[model samples]
Target: MPKGVYKLPEIKNEPIKSYAPGSPERQALKQKLVELSKGGLDVPMIIDGKEIRTGNLSDIRPPHDHQHLLGHYHQGDKTHVQMAIDAALKAKPAWEAMHWESRAAIFLKAAELIAGPYRYDFNAVTMTGQSKNAFQAEIDAVCELVDFYRFNVRNMYELYGMQPNSAPGIWNRTVWRPLEGFVFALTPFNFTSIAANLGGAPALMGNTVVWKPSKTAVYPAHLIMKVLKEAGLPDGVINLVYVGGKEAADVIFNHREFAGLHFTGSTGVFNGMWKTIAGNMDKYKSYPRIVGETGGKDYVFADVTADAKQVATALTRGAFEYQGQKCSAASRAYIPATLWDGVKKYMESDLKSIRMGVPEDFTNFVNAVIDEESFNKLAKAIDDAKKSPDAEVVMGGNCDKSKGYFIEPTVILAKKPDYITMREELFGPVLTVYIYDPEKLDETLDILDSSTDYALTGAIFSTDRVNIEKMTSRLTHTAGNFYINDKPTGAVVDQQPFGGGRASGTNDKAGSVFNLLRWVSPQTIKETFVPATDYMYPNFLED
Candidate 1:
């Protein structure tokens, strides 16, 4: 399996299942979801590859049915966070010494396990834990996670194959060295795939990791650890820790062995971590690699030539899917005055048909937001919008949290383009629209580019080829994944290569080689085939 001699296998994306009604896959997932919600599962933190059960227990419940307990996890303190870091550092020497092919095989096998045997378990747990409908769970846990594992394996192989061009007298080569110290992976709740990939990417690149998952995503994170373990991932290579972000910060950032950070969460937290790391920079062995994906005030724009149905479908799915919890979900839209009336009519009716309830209900498209904090934030935003003179609640703006944290699909029309909702990241199923004069298409692009601090994902709906090219060129820095006549949500792994810049993230492009590159430091290797016993060369000679 040595590079340059051995040919790497072609990699393709994992197919996404529709999980339509009455299908065998849907039926299987439904049965698993019911079993998971019975409330008997126990989760423990994996420190030194050994399960540690602290007395501190945290109850896990579905966001859509907050009254019922789905499971309980043992919480760890600062001691556990330190233990996990120590374990990862202890395991690094041996893990990094192992053959690259051996490391790659483990993740590829894990991908197969998720795509086949454990598919139902992964999807079901994601649905019950995150309150995602069947389709959402399938796309995220089953498909996207599989894609990250498989595609990342290919990326590893391809990266290793890169060698310097050699001349007749000598051979030059580059060896990708894993980071010198342990990496920390802090994951988020919106996508289970992210929870898996954040740690898995560093581990596959031969760097040991201390993974701390979001509190809301512990259930699915547990299953991810199980799959990786069953796939024969080496013990201590990737340790799972259940500790608060601050606890981790106190223990990890000060350690001389702290090498890198792979994070996906709030911008404020990432910024804070950056400041802390920089403050303690003198105490560390090396400058840490900080890669993150944060908040996005993402937007969508439609030209007068675009189809009303296309714009309508894009808005309905883009703004509301997964309860608009996606970092890339369209929060603001700029529509031309000519297309506003028709796009609005279709978009309103489309939102009206969406069913909001528990994820267990197969037909429900809208589920509750993650927790009460998120619910309150969204509820207040809607109330403020309704009271403002510059904004009009065009569609649903109601919220009732007695049973679960539920907020109906909402749309706000802003008289001015600079409405608060248009610029801030609501991170809920709320879309703010700003109607623009069709003649000022160029001016609207300028507004969209500067309105948000984050540059994550965006879309442009236009039938005109010239205008499409112009938008693509002018708003190049607005998003990492820019869509043409498509919604900004649902960024496919490998194909879309997700992440963004500015306040959004480092734009590592998670499913591509770029993200994996950050986990390693490359070293050049050169061999002199001929002896250079004489110090003098022809060029240096007096000839």
Candidate 2:
């Protein structure tokens, strides 16, 4: 068992009631749906003016305690994907033809709905389904959704006014337009806000979407659709499908009408999708757009000059937040040899204070992992690290899945910079700490850069302006999102643009204005005072 330097607060366990569909809560959800629909019936799937249902079903469970069943949702298949495509295909003409103000209004209302009473259910489903603590769940399901919607809309308005001139009489205006076909939103289980951002980004920009949320997060995604519907978004504008990845991928890649993809998940899956998209490039009706945020070996670097206490606190939250399941989770850390002992001591002390229990228990800092499979994977990774020749498991390396998918917050001390714990993306509450010489800052930075194929997020602690500047510039390619004097996790939506380069997936940053660009296609509209009907322009002809 792992030892702690301080005693953790004892967390009280609370029994939460199972959430059933058609209950008071469900009725409230239905009422929200009715309000958002403005009296239109809650159609499961709208395909070319028709309401279609696959009739397949799947049960969604709350991961916090695993005893509660969230609800049963319709599990869509290929036919459903096709139906969504057909709806989008039908709606695209009219939606694209509508004024931009109309399209923007739908999303603006969505942002307001998310900030209102819908916030409660959104928070509840996120807390239950994803096992996120109250604060974390609120930040994701409510705050982040609001931020993405508000910021994307505000930025798109700015993008509209941005124009470059060509000549005195002739002027060129660049307009960003949505792709001609449907955008497929494939989301991950980690953050509920991703469903809103991925689906809303496209829908806000006049493109309809077929969203395939992770099975683990279907309930929360369903509630999101509820909110959108309540917000008065037109039918066929946003289609939510609870389906397996293979079936969704078949529908997405095989359909010639598939226009773009907005994905967030594993690198292997992203690569596979890329290959499929590439192979089908010839058969595509249009050049499809693909934007993804994949794997990350995000890190936090603590030098001798760093504050040990702050590092400890940041690590506690960064490494164990959401059971370290986020792509931005801090999986690795580099500590200077001069402060390694103190840092370790602080970490050990802080680890004692980390209360692990159910999410509803507001005081509990850590909750169960997403499911049994994740728990097993995290446990095995910890065991492998413990057995590695160059590393020692200094803290937490245990699992108690009999109750729920729970694992102790783990910490590993690496004997060398090249240890396996430092090299891989362990998406769990496992932190690998490596001590290095403070004098070899350049070498340490290089080592950090080369240690992982993923370049999603990284952070450094330093008071020296020159060193910080140098490190920031040199390690630009190390992560798309970089931080100074802060933990790599807990990225804000408006300020920090998320996503990474290389194997970490697309560089389309998630939070800010950059993410909105992914859903739009730039079209240059040129106007001339004189009607030049001839093909040859003045530039091409000798003046």
Candidate 3:
């Protein structure tokens, strides 16, 4: 690698493989899952490139079968987080000084390994450990994960090439430097792609990170670390440590070197972190970058002219995929009064057809929610809804946690537009439907906007182009990712550039150039072709 200009091959999104019945990928995945089930892994915390086996341990298990032991992760204390931060700062100079092309090669190699050799391992771990079906696993761990690596590198290259314009007498340029201190990446348990992107994106841009992934997602998150190491990532660049939320914050937030917080979690947690960082601002060398994607009460609005089948399919897939654990999941839906019966009929039929069970069986489309806490919360919300007068369970409210944390795909019909379930985020497979009068389309949009504080992902279905245009204009600030005729959950990397604004996040779209910008601080450099020793201008002297 040299100081010359470089060009990478044009980037593209990795194609998703459907592990249909009797397919090759399907067979390979099943074999891998069986092999993993025989023996679980022993996860360890890696600080300064050395594995630290803390005597304290936490057992990892599949959400669908809590009785089945998957593995154990070494728990970390507050001291471990402090050690990781120190290690990241120690590794900063060399990694930041490394040539951009060399850094680019590492992530590109990682993408190839994930897409080719380690694909099965990642897919299997996500399916068995995270309780996602095979297709869900492929879309998350295999396809979108690779997309993040490819596009993130491309983004860095573009960002570095954007040198500042110069005057005739001087040469000017901008240097993209890594943050002054370390970044702390806090990931969620639902999406493996998100877990990989949260820390990897910053590391790719020459920033060292201290990663704290969710306990439930440690299975696939561990495998991701292996891929990065095998691809020639240097040790001590990104230290992986697992500790409790309070323990991590007590050390990370108050530390003077905390440069940024890259997070994908709940709104409550993000808000609290923001307040802590603001309160402790004087202790840090520089203002920390706060980038996060939090909770979303997403929606789907269908007009009278919209196709009934399309509306039904969107509700089924958007509201129930991955057990409705996505931040962009369609939790509240607005349908026209005239087409409510047809849409409801289609939704009920789809619910009856969707098979619910463990992810090991490829036939099952729905799986369990993440953990016991999530399961209990969803169960309580459903039970409360059933007892309320404003809401009725249209179909699928059965819940049985004796074997696993499984909640049937439940749909609640709301008599009032501003029902409680429609406003709050439940983070499960419970959707609320409210039928709006055809003449009150504008009023319904207002209600949707005022119902929840979050503005993440949303969709609209209408055959009339006039109504579509009107909704697009009137509801411009309602959602960050707005779909015309599609579901809200499936946001592609290059095409959609996913993220949202308001309560959802900072609206820094991930998997795009904008996200890479957050990790670098620009330094503008100015040069003079000829040196000038005189202090005063000739015009001033003559005058």
Candidate 4:
């Protein structure tokens, strides 16, 4: 072990490269896209740093062009899940005993590799496999992930420095120890950054992890494992497995050594996992730590004093970006009746300018949804709105899956506040707007707060300071991440530590020390320099 106290390098958010026309980043990214699109990879489950391939395989096709095969991942069963868990548990002692600085170095190295050499390759995989446009891929896959690794390292250093004040004759200290067993990271398909953090955060805290990424995202996930391995992450510290959800859950939750879970996905799925963990409580050595960021019907509420163009722009970008697959995507909006026509006109103009196609085209603002299920759900919601008297399809509501799962950037104008489109989380390029009376601002705020079970993200736009203050206070519990005079999406790391409460999640904010704290179990140690002969105090003896 090193003798001297160590300080980490300064952490800063990675600068986002503008992939503009004729730019070097654009040229490099285009070349990578072409290279990745030309061939398919054979992905395998990584257990104990060894590639394990099962004959059972699943093809990974690009969402924007379903006919084009990007790769094929070997699917694992329950046996592989067991193997992964065993690997994690077996590696726990050595990993947890390793010096904190060494662990930090590996993660920081991973971030540097992604930022320098692997940047374009990571962005290209995300764009093609996940159907994200170039800019979205940069923000989510490269910049945000790089930020997560660097900032998380800084957060860990600061967390370790937090020691208790020592008494006169006694020394008191707290050791932030990793949990007794292994962590299970169940990642989502939406953000490559989120998937990396889900597994990386726990492993960084000195815990071994069994990481199971989403099946749809195995393409980029394979790359993540490669980066980790190349960055000198030890074998069995994080075992990446491609197993079915049910099989993995059964093996993980029922295990005696299962210590924690780091997850990001739908609320319903999270609830089910919580139930299973609770049911298996008697079988485990300790209560499992459950940290998840789940679903959101995120909203934008524009006051009468708010600018129509700004609100329109917020809706267009927040709702249509990434085909509205974000948990914090703007799915619903409450617009004042007085500003309805202006907002409507501006939104119409903006939607008209957007071009939808594959992510390979630099100019296309939109791409296909993730798969057939999402496309069909959005199509049904649009058709239902067309038939409903309470709702009107105001903007784009076209769906065409003949070529790919393409759904137009749709806007539904709701006559009633409780319209079906207004309440449900149709995770697609669909935005529903409800116009409310400006005079009844308090009542409108109440409607917006109670419309959905989610409390993830929301925005309130207003030029009036008093109105902004009123709305902020009135809807305090309505959203975990609240925006003022801005759109509800695009939360940055360190700047905006994201997560939510209620049905959304446990509110253990990711990208901060709060989330890292969940992965550790601190033990307080107190040592007295002087010894006492008697067990009784002085007061008791005198009395």
Candidate 5:
């Protein structure tokens, strides 16, 4: 080991590229998008640093242009999942024993690669595959992923430096050890950054991981594997596979070497997985660390004193960005009747001005939702709202799937606060607004708090400091990532350590030392300077 205490690179958030027309990034990314749209890739299961092809191919299509074939990803079964587990276990011995700084260097290099040569490629893939517009892809696939890597490296260093106090005759030390077995990373489709970090965080802590990205997100997921490998990540450190959820879980949860699960997805799935892990507790070598950020019915609340136009802008971006597929997207709102008309007028104008189509069109503010299932769900919710006496379609209630799974940025106004659209998590470009009596502010806040099971992300808008303070206190636990006078989405790494409680997730805030700490099992070592030869004390003899 090197005797000198090593210092990491000065950490900073990666600057987001504007991708303005005629700019170099924009032109390069547009070219890359064209290339990828015709690439026709054959994605395979990556186990032990080798691509394993079973020949069971599933079509990969862009959400915005479903008919156009992007590629095909080979689907794996139980056997492939088993192979992944075996590969991860095989790699664990050498990986955990390697010097920690060596591991950090790989991710640091990955960050650099993402920020430089790979930036356009990543953003392009995200755009075509996931239907994120140029700016959205820029923030998510490139900027946020880079931030996760660089900030996590810094966090890992800070984590290792945390030590216990030493006495005059003894030295106390804490050794942060990787979990005894492999971590299973179940990543979501919405954010490529999340998919990378779900697997990267554990592996950075010296644990091997079996990564299973969402089927809808395989394009960027494959790219992430390529980036990590080029950055010198050893074979089997993180295995990427595509298989049915039940099939993967049956193999993973039943295994003795399953040490942890890093997940981002639905509340129902996380609950089921937790149940399965608990039922199989006796079979595991160590208790698995279950970390997940699940569903969110994220909200935006405006007080009587708030700016109507500002709230409208926040709603426009927060609710419809990424087609409202984000875990932190604003899905519901509680607007006071005093400002509801102005808010509604501004929102209508904003929604009218917004354009929705393929991500290739930079002028389009919104793109398609993930797939047909999501489209159907969102469509039904809009239809239900239109038919209901308690609600009315405020604006943009259209759903079109002729070429792709597209749903216009829909906003539903609920006469009653507890309408289904206001309560349930409709994960699409649909925002439900419930107008409340300004005099009954406390009652409205209560309804907002109790209406949803989620406590993921929310925002409060108020110019009055007294109401601001009151609203903050009242809705304290309603959102884990709460905001003031801003949209509830776009959580930057290290700046806003993100996660939530309630049905949302285990609030092990990612993008910080707290999330990294979950991956490690520490051992405290206390060494005494002198050995005691006698068992009896001096007072025993004197007495």
Candidate 6:
């Protein structure tokens, strides 16, 4: 382990309890889920008030030790996809015609429900299904989702203006409205808030959504649907499906009614979606809107003037939190050569102090990865990095998959900033560190800029005002969410708009007015108070 890094808190080991099957606390959850299952709330593939369930089904497993079964979800196929498109077509007219205030009120109620009695269920599913610790799960499943709901209500009114235009004896006005067709949302497993934001945002903006959530997060997605239904959202406003990547791609790419795609996942998947959308452009009903937030290789730069303790804490927490699965997780660190020795000592000591264990324990700071596949991926990456001549594992390259997908928190010291370990997105409890000359800050920034195709998030730590200004300005193009004294994670909704640019994504900043605008299509409507009395008004005829 690295020298002076603090150990994470320890967790108590005990048999995991199911919060949904029979517990008293789960009575409401069970009733809600059962209600949803029995058609109290609508499922996916409903068109024109008709419920269409495709025979295809798939099992979804909670990642807490990978032994718990969350339940099964309908796997939407081509026919179901078409049905969803048709349903959106049927509902769009009436939904869009409703007063915006009514739509906003539904979303506000949903937020209230999430913050109320259902908060625990949301957090529970997030912890078990996504393998996140309590704090991380709470932030993802509760706080962020609530914030998005509240923020976007205001954003809707802001993005869609209501002012009227006037001229000499003439009046005109313009209105922003939802797209004419269905919007598809492909969400990731790392964040449950994304499921709501991607689908709910569009739905609130008067666009019906066909959402395919990650199989690992099915339970939470279902709960979100329950909350929406209980909050008084009409049936067919948002449809939920659970399927693998190929199935989702088939539905998204081939459907003519497919108006757009909102995606968050791997770069390979994002690129593939882009290609598929482009290839089938001629088949779509209208020009499709593609908004995505893909993979990221974010970094944290530590200058000699930076506080050693603060830098250590940020680097350690950013890299190990959520098993380092977040898109904005700090995967690499660049330290000034002059402070490398001191920073290394501090990080090592702190790392040694970090404790890791199962999720139920409130004191447990780190939990398992999402599943065995992710664990294997992290293992392979660590093995490859260990073999590199210029790199050494300072701490944590161990994995025990006998019971759970557990990997020790890991750190690597690199000889160069351009090392392979520093260039890729590890997406695990692993971080790579590089030492560079402070005077070559520009050179360092250039290397980082070109190292990876991702431009999601990055941070710089320096007390020098000149250095801070210079680095911020020069590296502005390198990241979407930039930070000075803070870590890349914990992005608050109202304060910092999320999402990325360049290969990372479309730069549609989530949690802001801009993100809400993506779901709406602005239309200019003009009306004249008086009809034209004459078609021809020549200069000689003018009186």
In terms of lDDT, the poorest run of 10 residues in model 4 is: 1-10
Predicted candidate 2 versus true structure: per-residue lDDT over 314-422, tens digit per residue: 8888898888998999989988888777777887887788899887666688898998888888888888877888889998887888767888999998999988779
Candidate 1 per-residue C-alpha lDDT over 1-543 given as tens digits, one digit per residue, 9 for 90 to 100: 445455546678888887787788888887887788778878999888799999799999888888998768999989998899889988999999998888888998999999999999998888888888888998999899999999998898889888899988999999999998999999999999999999999999999999999999987888898899999898899999888888988999989999999999989899999999999999888889999998898888999999988998998999999999999998999999999999999987898789999988988999999999999999999999999999999999999999999999999999999899999998999999999999998898999888878899999999999999999999999998899999998888777899988899889999889999999999998899986899877898685
Question: How many pairs of residues collide in each model?
Answer: 0, 5, 0, 0, 0, 19
Residue 428's lDDT within candidate 4 is 88
**Best model per lDDT:** 5
**Candidate 4 deviant stretches above 4 angstroms:** none
> Candidate 5's residue-wise lDDT over 1-543, tens digit each?
457799787999999889887899888988998899886799998999999898999999998888898779999999999999999999999999988888999999999999999999899989998999999999999999999999999999999999999989999999999999999999999999999999999999999999999999987998999999999999999999999999999999999999999999999999999999999999999999999999999999999999999999999999999999999999999998899999989988998899889998899999999999999999999999999999999899999999999999999989888899888898899999988888999988999999989999999999999999999999999999999999999999989999999999999998899999999999999999997899998888963
Weakest lDDT window of 10 consecutive positions for candidate 6 = 7-16
**Colliding pairs, model 4:** none
Residues 1-543 of candidate 6 have per-residue lDDT tens digits of 235423222211112224434565345444443333332222343334444456565555555455544445566666666666666677778788887777888888888898787777787777766877666876778888888888888777667665577887676666777886889998988999988899988888899888778867766877888888888788777877655678767866887878888888888888988898999999988888889899889999877788877888888888889989999999999888887777778878987877777776545678888888898989988887789888888888888887788888998888877888788887889999888998987788888888888889998889989889988998888899999988888788878889888788988988788887788777776677788998876875856
Better candidate number, 4 or 6, judged by TM-score: 4
Encode model 4's per-residue lDDT on 1-543: one tens digit a residue. Answer: 448788678899999999999999999999999999986689998999899999898999998899887778999999998999899988889889988888999999999999999999999999998999999999999989999999999999989989999979999999999998899999999999999999999999999999999888987888998999999899999998998899999899999999999999999999999999999999999989999999999999988999999999999999999999998999999999999899999999998899999999999999999999888888999999999989999898899998889999999999999998788788889999999999989998998888889999999999999999999999999889999988899999999999988889999989899999999999999999997888987788653
CA-only RMSD, every prediction: 1.4, 10.1, 1.2, 0.9, 0.8, 9.4
Write candidate 3's Cα lDDT for 162-223 as tens digits: 98889888999999999999999999999999999999999999999999999898768778
The 0-to-1 C-alpha lDDT of every candidate, in the order given, reads: 0.91, 0.78, 0.92, 0.92, 0.94, 0.78
Error of 1 at 190 (Å): 0.7
Q: List the residue pairs that clash in candidate 2.
A: 5-348, 6-349, 8-352, 8-353, 36-230
| TM-scores of all predicted structures | 0.98, 0.88, 0.98, 0.99, 0.99, 0.88
lDDT of 2: 0.78
Number of the candidate with higher lDDT, 1 or 2: 1
lDDT-sorted candidate list, best first: 5, 4, 3, 1, 2, 6
